[model samples]
Target chain A: MFKRGTLVVVAFVLAVLLTACGGAPAAPAAPAATDAPVAAEPFKVAVVMPSTETDLAWSQAMIDALRSIQAEMGGEAAMQISISENMFNVTDAAAALRDYASAGNQLVIAHGTQYGTSMFEVARDFPEVSFAWGTATDTGEAEGFTNVFSYNASAEEGGYVNGVIAAMLSTSNVVGIVGPVEAGDAKAYIDGFEQGVLSVKPDSTVNKTYTGSFGDTAAAAEAASTHIAAGADVLTGSAQQVVGAIGVAKERGALWLGTQSSQASLAPDIVVATQLYDWTGVLKDIIAKIQAGTLGGTAYDLTLENGGLKIVFNSAFPGVTPEMQAAVDTAIQGISSGVITVLP
Target chain B: MEQLFTLTTLTGILHSTIRLATPYLFASLGETISQRSGVLNLGVEGQMLMGAFAAFFVVVTTGSLLGGVVAAIFVGALLGLLMALVSVSFRAEQGISGIGMYLLGLGLSSLLFRLTLGSVQSVRGFAELALPGLSSIPVLGPALFKHSLLVYVAFALVPMVAYLLNRTTWGLNIRAVGDNPQAADTLGVPVIAIRYATVTVGGAMAAMGGASLSISAVNIFQENMTGGIGFIAVALVYFGGWRPVGVMLGILLFSLVSALQIWLQLVGIGIPSDLAVMLPYILTIIALALAPRRTGQPAALTRPFNRGMA
Candidate 1:
């Protein structure tokens, strides 16, 4: 019995070693996708998202942008948009990303920062597949790849706008921040918002709380309630969990400033303004580049000046007076022209 | 500390604590009965998710909280019945069966949410029922008296659940089947039937917990809404040692720490918010470590019963 067991174990070890040796060899310089320039027959685009498409935060914003892109360029029949959403597991996400590229998708978009590693690795395998990913700035330029396009948003531009409006709308001289995790975009939005508030109303207190999760609605709601209890008449938050906060703002009648997407559909009575990220311009440009055979080298940055960041005030919210509109316009102009720096 | 422990802060903490505890309490109480009857249902989390989705769907379509909760209870009961068929009648491995149930709940809820809502829309939630004269009383009055109707039901269930499990003849049969199924069968107690009934009831309770979360507390449905709170409910049974009051106390300890962390973040306490989040989990680990050497789980728990000649 002992001899048989030892034989089986040794055989297993040998098999593993042989399998490892037979895997893909290291390639020094892979061929670029631009060499072939695959013709776009109907513009097949596939995207992978970290959460549900209806989360109303990061994933929802991108899905809405993709939908709008399809509508503008023609209908879904013409654009052929395919999405794999609620992929919280990175491993599953990587597999889906590979499948889409291998199945002849014209342009594949991996829509989460966590997917960066898997996306770059997969992009190497299919040199003809144009890949885009972000909330990051690295376009694989340093990696010597010409088929990878990167996209990131200048959320602070909207964050600054949200802040100026929050500071103006806060009746209690106190504004609260219910932040998702301290990621780059969320942090930029929060910091720029604080700067905008202090610049306008220095005396107002801005308390910030990170729920340490991206999708836990109850935790977000708990943070929001605590802020309301602490005398914050005005609140601002970012991410999908902001839905929880939106529920609270609606219940308590507290003014809410939104970011990333247009949240006016939710809590119409309380939502004052939202810095909606309109990626139509960026999406159109990426498609245009693909048609022109540029595949990837350019990294698109969605900012206020380039008509990517749109500040949409909720028409249903009662506090949108003419004076408030003028102040917001001035802030927008100042930020666009480099007169008002919103780096934080 | 003195400055932070004001009346308003205490009230706020209490308010959030009750809402947070509602789902946990409903789930644990239901689990307590199932475990007491010697059946382990690991699919409580899945059941909770199903219940949450069912309630949210009904309420969104019909605009009635009563209809939503009723649908959740029905869904929960059906799931409980299914669990009995998988684990009891078919005599499949309980652990694997429970896991199958979990995956079903997780996947189905997400698919249903996408197919139905397709977007995040706020639905109506239950109103806070403040006891007029009592709510005017100092500290405890405002904190305890002001809560939604579901919160009151969750608290009231404790004593009622305790009574149902302790004093009734039906309870005796359940305990008998759990402790010694052969003896129960010989005594004409209908062991299989008792186990099936207990597990089904447990399922209903777990689903109500989900209903409390989506319909009464959060008023919005998203994928995996219960998020692992159902797994925590399972842990709670072990922590509570299969008793109603004990389970309630375990939930309170966890929620109190959670409430404290939220309040501290607002008061500008210097502790990192992540560390604050870890406090309750750390406390649960400590509680389990300090628990008695022998937990009072039923003898036949997780074991499928056979009639004779084993």
Candidate 2:
């Protein structure tokens, strides 16, 4: 009887083990009707993410947009749409792009700023495969080659919004920013922040620090603490999960803001607002251009005017009076009306 | 204004020193024991990664942290057994076999994560644990007890390991076998069985160290998340003079460097942040070079003990 019970327990353990390891399988097969494979001349589009899609931030937004595009084509596709993620190296980018093209993917999207150099190098080889890069600066020729194009947000406008909030909320007359990397792309936001702050508190001092990494939370937290120690009451950044700054702010009870997404949820008490970049809109434009055949190799400068950047305020910031809200509204109108040109 | 470098910051650094020290301590301790048993387990890093992946995946799936820890230990043990099989029974090259196991573990865990999660970006990490009473202490509380349960486990294992190695009969046998496997075999000790046991236990402990990173510290598993912590553990073995207490000190020193980088940056020490980051690695090399080399490692370490010679 003991031996039988032991056998039964062993079987039960095996079942649990298998279930745990293999619990999450691929999305269930679409209905039989939806499974009918559509046929057409294949136009291959390969999407590459620097990180995985589960990140729920920049990479996730891009993946979500791509998924929506995939869904629009149908449950299944005639055009081979391959999505590659977690490419940390420039080498990984080159390999994936080559793999996509070799696998007959005609259109390749390098969906990370880090992939800019790699994409440009590989694009020279695969001129037939149209390349789109999400970066601030485009080293690739504009409409010269039949392949390369760049799409980036007007972070200047987004930065201006956060600057306006910081100017209004900062009690110390000093604010700080923790940048991911000090580059042209990151500089645009800083310029805009300066412009926005000067628009309100012309004499306000902006102390900026770069963590030299996109997602090193320890560095971000340390940088934020330093900024806070320097009498900066408000801080903001455009880094990946700059929420580490908010985490610091939460620990020290300092005001903070973020760019690229609604991270007000990160520290609801401290976060004034976030400049949400609509990556879906950016992806939609790419798809639309592809569909229209007007997608030329040009630097796509998407702005608030084009629904690329938005300033989202948190309801938790009750201290933000209607006058403060109106100030932000006025700045948005000023940018849209061409009265205020946010520096590029 | 509080001075940039204050007692509070120093205390924070010390606490962080302890928190980061755990994984390295656990891994090196495990490696030390394995080495002491005349076996070189090069698969500690891989075993740790596999353990981390298994633990994290299980927790995410079942929503039970304790179950995840248990699952990680099982996965670690299985990998350890595999390592022992190739290195002990087959008498394979310990280093090469270890490298193979590392590659397999890293590749398998990453593949499994991607296959299971379907290429999402950042997954949420585990919540931090705050000990009810201990966490209330001003500086030490947040620095020590406020860390993950796994971190605490790493420290606890240090004393236990020291006792196991110095005071116990099995420990003496392990030392005897590692020092001279053929001699131990002649004396009627089950040299092979003990080697397997030590190597297996070592793997499991190393895995637990890995679980600390995934389930406590970072909570998110990135590619190559071990970040050469395994190698650091190996170096610690030599630095600690193959002793558990000495190994913990090495772990503490390494952790201190990591914490110091952050603390310096926070206090605006003005050394250029990049340079500050490099200090830990530079310090590691210096510490290794300066450590007393008098204490000899196990004589038969990295060698297969053949009982037939007896």
TM-scores of all predicted structures: 0.91, 0.77
**Candidate 1 lDDT, A93-138, residue by residue in tens:** 9999999998768789998888999999999998888999988888
Question: Which of the numbered candidates is closest to the native, going by highest TM-score?
Answer: 1
The DockQ values of the predictions, listed in order, are 0.47, 0.10
Pick by DockQ: which candidate is best? Answer: 1
Q: Model 1: per-residue lDDT, tens digit, B1-79?
A: 5636888888888878877888999989988888777788999989999999999899999999999999999999999
The true-structure Cα RMSD of candidate 1 reads: 5.9
DockQ of 2: 0.10
lDDT of 2: 0.75
Assess the local accuracy of residue A34 in candidate 2 as a C-alpha lDDT between 0 and 100: 30
lDDT of 2 at B111: 87
* Model 1 lDDT at residue A24: 38
lDDT of 2 at B158: 86
